[model samples]
Target chain A: MSAAPELNPAIEVAGLRKRYGVGDTAVDALKGVDLTVQPGEVIGLIGPSGSGKSTLLKCLGAVTEPSDGRIRLSGETVYDGGWHDLDPRALRRDRIGFVFQAPYLIPFLDVTDNVALPLLLAGRSNREARQRARELLAALDVQHRAQAAIAQLSGGEQQRVAIARALANQPPIILADEPTAPLDSERALAVVRILNRMAQQYRTAIIVVTHDEKIIPTFRRLYHIRDGRTYEEAGAGRDLG
Target chain B: MISLAGRDILHSWGKYAFTGLGLGLLIGVTLSMAGIYRGMVDDGKALLANSGADLWVVQRDTLGPYAEPSSLRDDVYRGLLGLPGVAHAANVTYLTMQARQGKREARVMVVGIQPGEPGEPRYLIAGRQIERTHYEAVADASAGFQLGQRVRIRRHDYTVVGLTRRMVSASGDPMVFIPLRDAQEAQFLKDNDAIVNERARVRANPALNRPGAPGLAETVSRSQESSRMVNAVLVQVAPGWSAAEVAETIRRWKRLQTYTVPQMEEILIAKLIATSARQIAVFLLILAVVSAAIVSFIIYTMTLGKLREIAVLKLIGARNRTIAGMILQEALGLGLIGFLVGKTVATLWAPYFPKYVLLEPGDAARGFAAVMLICALASTLAIRTALRVDPATAMGG
Candidate 1:
């Protein structure tokens, strides 16, 4: 496994395992899960409650260490049995982005700043970061709300701004956890459409963790996790474009 | 990077303003307490300065006319003036009592001094000094006395002939100057009934009414009715003589407790008001602790309320230091506003207090630094909580 060539997969995992506690109290949250995502691809990860969907997302996001796994991003091994010599915070800032169930836009920041935050954390000049944020906001069709406060935006607009923020750093991978849990069918489909467009335009791989039945049919490929194990399947491939 | 603390404060400025206002009032009271202590010390110094005395000759082994009771013969100034360095010496008495004017009564320190003496008030802001020794008085302006107004002291009514400013006692009581003879009579005069009873008791004693000593009873009665005791002797040193040198000569030769101006100041400030100073210090310490506790509670609660947002920030790659800095900055901002408000209110209300309140710039500067330090210390609790937020918690596992 150590001699494997760098295939440049946006995100890849094999035999990822996460166990809580030790001895009799030990419980496995993820049991030898394997996954792969190609560039410019948007994949759906769906599962029932307590089925380790979030556990897998957490492992891939580099927010938590896996007990045993081989993980790679952009041809670099991030976790091989144990985490490599990389700052996890820098990994999240420069190589990965996250979207939550709620837009979770920083309440105090306007649209532009909320989008520019990741770039700022990555040591970009304020002007350059804000300029990059503006360009992304324009691409997301939310340029008109660049200076609007988070509370001023409608639910769908807030979600679009959140997507812009996730794509701000140009990360190779984005982990969106239930990105449309609060939206109706129309807004939910619109969010999925935006995510797909952003992934393709930016050449980024995105994994969307969701329980929304309405948007399940849109993905070309899907991963279903049951009891800490993943089963891959082909989706309905609905034409969302 | 955009200032997360500034944005958060601006977002909920109303909450911060109200909280700061409450804390500011507490700070205001703390400052005022400190001001009162300073005022007391200044009053003690002023009293010593206005007396225009180089040395104070008090009774042997006594603290003095201010801190303790000290009685000397009224003729003690005669012997003190005979000393080599003594330019002029005057007997003086001090008694704290109530002065009644019409329907109001004011607490005043009655000072007995002879006309043209070192113990007289240095300057008068209004009217003339007392010319008629028996029924004339000079009062401090704080006593609310008007010229020619009759004020009752003891069993006699004396007209206020002059008003002086800042002529206060060590305890901040306004000084009222009267003739030494009148003050002596007032101090020792007994009620008519008591005097009559004393006379009968004396006549009834066979030893005192001895047939061989006919005029002895009359002489003893006359002596008992007269008061010749004074509290202290105020002395002025001649040119080319240091007050310390003169005071030391009096202490050694006259067998009396003598104090130079600086030594008297020490007695007045360090000894007289030491307890009060300690009390204010304790109050300031308690207020500081309370302010810190309040700031900690508020910052901790505010941070706890943002736990979810903090998780999201951490997950999005915000460093621990950055998050902690945000919380710390908010606490400091609150403290700044509170200090400004507290200083303003304390200045505005200082003059209305009964005792003088001296708000010194040095004290204010020290207070501001203390407030900042307290705020910084208080923010640590909130910062610690924010730092402990696990980024993985954002995944809801």
Candidate 2:
């Protein structure tokens, strides 16, 4: 494949550090980390337990403020030193998407409502939110079960719905933690393929955090974190088709 | 926008409905307590209405005639009738006693009324009113005395000739109407042994049984047999004259207590049943507190169960106010169901009470509003807990 033209980085971080407690009792979790990701790219994040994988994910997701860092997403500076330039909740709602280990769909809401919640929160009308959710569900190939209750769907169907929800607002970046850890090898590769197809179709960047070994070879680029720092690595790029 | 509260409730409707049913039973007890108090007041008013008298001329400086012991000479009506604006006056006496029919007995308020006067039973539901000068009685159906049944009062046996409805004393005691002479004797008569002993004591007194005074024993015996006192004089004011004016004249000139229709109503409602109203008010306060506590406990538990979901929603950009509103709406929905169930239950069981249970539409409306307000206030605790949840917990490391 030709070397793809790199667009302006969707996420750029520098000197990101986080510490818990104070004084002599303080323990550093993330020690001066730096990272970058371009739009329309799917990158894997892997680390041993307690290797600061979650801390880095929280800082990236805008859920936890870093003690000392500079974070710029889509050309907008979000965090610097001890302050955040944007509302964290609004940022999470409008620009960032999160998928979790289990498909944590709200049990009370139907599949469509679960997917449309972010769009609705972002001030879209019901019809508009529903239309967007339907398109995303159709893209994820789960449109037939959009109106079903979250509990009625199978595990795979539920995961697909969660993925649809993540792309509901067409956020430029998606952060998924342990997205395929529970699935077997075939299902795990299927999830990675779907993520790749979505990133290419929507031109969105995605960071997948996982420790599962079966699907690690599918990525072209990967980041391995050890001792609170990330190092870039080349993937196996094995063909599944 | 989708209503998170509505969707949650619909998802667990069975659980919510069962909880509401439990709360509704509590509310039903509260409403029934209120109705009981109203029944007592209504019974007092009914007693006055059934009396059919415009003025009650009682003994001097006393609130009696019904609430306390009262006595005036039976002949006082003759003097009261002579006054201007007094169209008719009748001597009436009230005595609460146990009347026996064969093997069964019931507590009844015996009203001594003169024939063809204002003190008689206003209307009958079954038989005719007392047409005889003696031995005929009219009993309220609640007293369980059937027509033609012989009921013994004191030493006399009277046949039940009439039955009335809605005639009760302030204390919910049914009433029985008898002739003035019989009622007076039944109320004040001594036993046979006591009468003999009284006669012997009179003879033993030298001033009363002088040897030269013939027929002295007989005269003394006649005095012992007669009942000269009555409870009150029931008076009717002439047309074009005010009852208050007549009552005032009697109070000033006759040196006796007089109560007009409105004044008598005050005595029955405010003075006679004041303590009962306070009792009911205290019960209402306790029930309200209990309802609030129960609602709070239920809502708090429900919110605790959904803590995980709330954290997830918060992490995904749900506002604190949105989550709080959802919890409050669920509590309010439960309260609405409870109030409807409570009101319906109270109304259905009202007629079964031994006493009248007056369920006013206005009281029910106020009760419903209060229930909703209380529920809204009670849900604040759960809402606060939910809003304080940290979105970081959803990560669940």
Candidate 3:
């Protein structure tokens, strides 16, 4: 097997645009947005409601098609004008990881399977997938709850498992949308600390889209999105310890 | 790959089992309806087989002996016995009425057969065939009669001498074989009050009670009270002769309607119980449709409940077929559980039915296939819903 290419930026987007409908009734959700995140970096994307944070997250996650854009993940172009790869589903499965506002752990699956699902979907053997999931859970400090049901976990524990699931495939980048919105100040900051630790440990680039102001100071870099456009800025970069 | 549907079912087994049980009862009723129809057909065949006859000779232009009423002279069997290729022939009478033993009563087919004749029950499970011509009777075990038990026909009481199995008519009424003379009297005899009223009316009428004819009133009254008619003559063909040929011979010379075994079977199954079978078929169809609807509604609701989960799964790159397969498998699993429960319950309760319920294995296999097919078809609605789920929904607006 070939080793992964040494890429500086885990995800790069240039001039991304997304529009709903057509003609007079159309609304542009994302307009020529440009952003990039390097490996081993945790950045924050903060915006008010209806300011295209979701639209950007969806475009970056490879779920919704961007009307026009160039998107590269781990030094490979995934979308240029239209998807360069025909199977966006496979691209998403192999390349992208997602963390949602709620834990959104599959209720029927136990923690291990929920975390292992991405690897399984990637056609890994069950044992290998489970081994990888356990490793992630251990790193996330939720290994003790690996066999527990999603319903049996606290909100913080559920979010931690969700993080483990997002890291299951060892993706180069993760898109987190409002992941800390449901957490308290301490737990939200704790989640940010975990995210930073995971990013450094796995060399992953994570973009957290949030309205939560509690964890904003922890990001070394932040992007402020307004009216479908983003402006990059340096953050307080406060110590999480 | 992990089985999402299996895990879901295992996690909520209690809910799925309860739902399966409810569906199972409906399926059980549907299977029983099919069994009832089969039983009717089997009863007809058994009736023909137990009669030990190759041809049935009834009144001309009638579908008789079982499907319709036909009256032939009591001496018709002697003429049938003399025909070429004739082995043995006997007079038989059949009347469906309430047979009572004290206060307990059952609807039974009263069969009148000569001792050691063609129409006698083929085998006895208990006791012996009727030895006396007057009041001895042989009863089918399904009639709930015991040997030596006294059963009352219309006017006289008779003792059950034998018990037989599967000796039932096309309608599933158990047979109670009595002597020809007794059955004739019971079938034709009128009540004493009605007899007296008829005699008085006849005497007052000059046309019936002529003063010039002294013995006319007595003759008229004797003729009114006597019955020398038999329902049909059961004939056995010789070993070398074809039943159709013998039936044709009888129809030509005897001037009576003759039916070979197959023809008789057609009449009993196709004509006698046709309406009842159609009714049962309609019921089975309705139950199948209802089962499909219930399965569809349940799967659709379950899929709707998992909308967010489905969205997440899709966003995480689970293929559309994978999601659809999960829903389809769940529906099939539900159907399998329901079918097992249904078959068990149907078998357990079949004997308690008033008529025989025949649950043939072939029918069960077909039923299983049908249930699976229905479940698969029913899951399509849920699968479509799951597929339509937007993965972007998981990103949240």
Candidate 4:
């Protein structure tokens, strides 16, 4: 097999716009937002409530369509001049990963299968997907609980499995929406630490949307969105020791 | 891909099993309803088969001996015997009434058949055929009659000398067969006081009591007390002739209604029991509707409870068909459970029914197919709702 090709600028968005409803009742959620992130970079997106942070994440994750935007993942155009220039669902499955505010792991599945789900959905064989899930779980320090049911796991362990699921297909980009909303200060910083380490090891770009104060200073770079617009700045880059 | 549906079911097997059991009982009732209708039709066919007649010759324009009332001269069988293709003919009478043994009584169809005649019981399960003609009767085992039991019909009591199996009327009434003369008398006989009053009234008529006709009124009064009329004449055609052809000849020569075996079957099953068949059909339709509704409601409710799980599946890039396949498989699984339980329970309870409940294998196969179809259709509502679930909702859950 040929070696996998590498792409720069893991995620790129320009003048993204999203509006809900039509006619006199329409409300603009995202207006002309522009952003970029490179491979192996972990960026923070922080803003007050109703500042278009969720709208931006939905647009990037392909969960919702943008009214007008230019989006590229791994240097390939996804949406430009129309809603779907590329197959949106296939693009999402192959190139993008998502982490929600809650772990939302399937209660019916065990911890290993929950993490292996994306690989399975991507059409990988069961043994291969499970092997990959085990490797990621070990790296995240939750491999001992691989055989446990989702409901049997602690909150931190469940969140760890969720992260493993996001990275299952080795996607070029991951969009985390309020992933630390339910965690305490220690657990929240631990989640950020894992994200940073996984980004470096896998060369995967990640964007975390958070309102938690405990882990805000951990990002070296932050993007503040206000009134559907973005302002980039630096973070405290605090040490965990 | 891993089977999401299988995993989910395994996780909650107890719940699924209990739900399936409840649905199974409803399905069992539906299958029994279908069996009851089949039994009614089988009863009609069996009633015709036991008569041992190839042709039924009755009064003109009447379907008789089983369905409608008809009366013919007792000597009509002699003339029918003379017709070509007519091997043998015998007069027969039918009267549906109560037969009492002490205080216990049973409603039965009293059939009048001569010895070695076409309308006689085909087989005896117990005891011997009637030897003494006057007060001997053969009763169906279904009527709970045993050998040597004396059953009273009208004023005279008759001994049950023989027992037959499956000897029943088209309406499922067990039969009590007696000699032709006795059945004729039992059908038309009156109380002694009423008979004496009838003779006196006839003598009082001046035209009949004329001086030149001194004995005419007496003869007329005696005639009024007796009858030589029968319900029908059962004819057996020779093996060389077609029953239809013989029936046509009889109808043309005798100027009476003639029904071949197939025609008699049509009269007994289609015309005689049409109302009962329609009632069973309505019941089957209502049961089918109720079963479908229950399945739909169950699946839809289950889907509604798992909205968050469905959203997460979709948001994680699981294809829409994957989610739909899970719901479809679950519905079909429920149906399979129901069908197995239904078939088992229907078989278990069939023999205890008051009427015969014929659970044919073919009908069970059809019932299986119907249950699967209904479950598949019932899953559509849940599938639609799951597909419409927005994947973004997981962000909140």
Q: Which pairs, if any, clash in model 2? A: none
Q: What is residue A110's positional error in candidate 2, in angstroms?
A: 1.8
Docking quality (DockQ) for each candidate: 0.69, 0.66, 0.78, 0.58
Fraction of the native A-B contacts that model 4 recovers:
0.68
Model 2 CA lDDT for position B35: 88
Candidate 4 docking quality: incorrect, acceptable, medium or high: medium
lDDT of 1 by residue, A1-241 (tens): 0112235778889899999899999989999999988888889999998898888888888888889989999878999987799888888888998988888888888999999999998889999999999999999999999999999999999989989998999999999999999999999999999989888888889999999999998888899999899999977678886
- TM for every model, in the order presented, reads 0.96, 0.94, 0.96, 0.93
Model 4: per-residue Cα lDDT over B45-163, one tens digit each: 88778888999999988998788999899999999999999999999999999999878898899998897888899899999887777899999998877899999999999999999
Model 4 pairs whose backbones collide: none
The candidate with the higher lDDT, 1 or 3, is 3
RMSD of 4: 3.3
TM-score for chain A in each prediction: 0.96, 0.96, 0.95, 0.94
Give the runs in model 4 whose Cα sits over 4 Å from its true position.
A1-7, A22-24
Model 1, residue A139: displacement in angstroms?
Answer: 2.1
Residues B26-69 of candidate 1 have per-residue lDDT tens digits of 88998999999999988888888889899999999898989999
Q: What is the TM-score of chain A in candidate 4?
A: 0.94
- CA lDDT, every model vs. true structure: 0.90, 0.87, 0.91, 0.88
Name model 1 segments beyond 4 Å from true.
A1-7
Model 2 TM-score (2 dp)? 0.94
